[model samples]
Target: MTGAESWAREQGDAYISLVSRRAGEFYRALANEDAATFFKKPL
Candidate 1:
């Protein structure tokens, strides 16, 4: 993978670790997720 992709993967791991059912940061983190990944449908 490219450097950016690798970096994102690493960051994703960190995010997954930080995710919690008790906290609402998961939604905020998901909101910050790259739009390209969030919206992959063809327009």
Candidate 2:
């Protein structure tokens, strides 16, 4: 994670990843915040 973040910084890009709903709390506990929320609709 550290290496990836560093590389992203060098390239002037944001480091992001997707976490499963079950693991959301785990990542949040690490001080990572959600950049956005996704929604789905079924026709």
Evaluated at residue 34, the lDDT of candidate 1 is 27
lDDT of 2 by residue, 1-43 (tens): 6787788899999666775668788888877788777788998
Error of 2 at 18 (Å): 3.1
Compared with the true structure, model 1 gives a TM-score of 0.27
- Pairs that collide in candidate 2 are none
Candidate 1 residues 1-43, lDDT tens each? 2465468787775432233345456545545332232224787
Candidate 2: residue 22 Cα off by (Å): 2.0
RMSD of each: 10.4, 2.3
Top candidate, metric lDDT: 2
Query: Over 4 Å off in model 2, which ranges?
Result: 14-19
